[model samples]
Target: MRMNPTFIVMMKCSEEAGVQNPVFQRLYICLGALKKGWKEGCRRILGLDGCFIKGFHTGQLLTAIGVDPNNQMYLVAYALVESECKDTWC
Candidate 1:
């Protein structure tokens, strides 16, 4: 589906809201992007910060992995940690 001005890429509900399910539409869009270009030269050292939740629990330190332009091992992966550790992260 062509992206309209009001098309929501993602949503929390399964039921249709404004237009044909925004979530599905967004999924399709993402899939299209993936198909358009394969992951290459995207790997790089990934640095991530902690992420918190909305519950009765303390915030969590997490990491995110991604590639760089040179396809080098960027942020490898995200792991829950007690605190921020730069040396341990990279």
Candidate 2:
């Protein structure tokens, strides 16, 4: 299978930015899809929430956002928060 240049570039960029592996490839795809879909239509959101993983203590942090309309999933955004503020997740 052919490798994606964006992943390669993102991995290198992440390393340079001091971010660890298992990086933001999925979120990147979601963002790219959203960008493409914007020309088609705008996505509406009903409710959004974030979930935690990797136990209470870990190397990196994660938060998930979902963009939905009429119970249909459209887009998602994930953030790696490095702060203690659980409410202020991206």
Candidate 3:
């Protein structure tokens, strides 16, 4: 048996104003390896939704979940935004 190397595919974050606020207005997650795997095993259709977060910062979680052949849900991509406005969706 053989094992592949471990590494970080994607990692990113955006801050609000100067370092003072340090709050992230938006956050995204998309793993390069997962994307490639999805293309090979997942369906073409993707389900998306947004929900409010009750934490201190208070925001919306936008996500795209992939529906596999077995009707299972797999995370494809996601984002945390300050709001769920039209501009943000676009």
Candidate number achieving the greatest TM-score relative to the actual structure: 3
User: Which candidate ranks first by lDDT, i.e. highest?
Assistant: 3
Candidate 1, residue 43: Cα displacement in angstroms equals: 3.5
Clashing pairs for model 2 are: none
Name the candidate, 2 or 3, with the larger TM-score value. 3
> What is the lDDT of every predicted structure here?
0.40, 0.39, 0.71
- lDDT digits (tens) for residues 1-90 of candidate 3: 124333223323456566654544677676656666677889988889899999667988888888777989978888877788775654
In the predicted model 3, the residue pairs found to clash are none
lDDT of 1 at 53: 41
Whole-model alpha-carbon lDDT for candidate 1: 0.40
Question: In lDDT terms, how accurate is model 2?
Answer: 0.39
Q: By summed lDDT, which 10 consecutive residues of candidate 3 come out lowest?
A: 1-10
Candidate that beats the other on TM-score, 1 or 3, i.e. the better one:
3
- If the candidates were sorted by their lDDT against the true structure, best first, what order would they fall in? 3, 1, 2
* Tens digit per residue, CA lDDT, model 2, 1-90: 144332211111124455556333222123555444533554543334445446654323343334444445554434444333643332
Give the Cα error of residue 50 in candidate 1, in Å: 2.1
> What's model 3's overall lDDT?
0.71
RMSD of each: 11.9, 7.2, 4.9
TM-score of each: 0.29, 0.36, 0.70
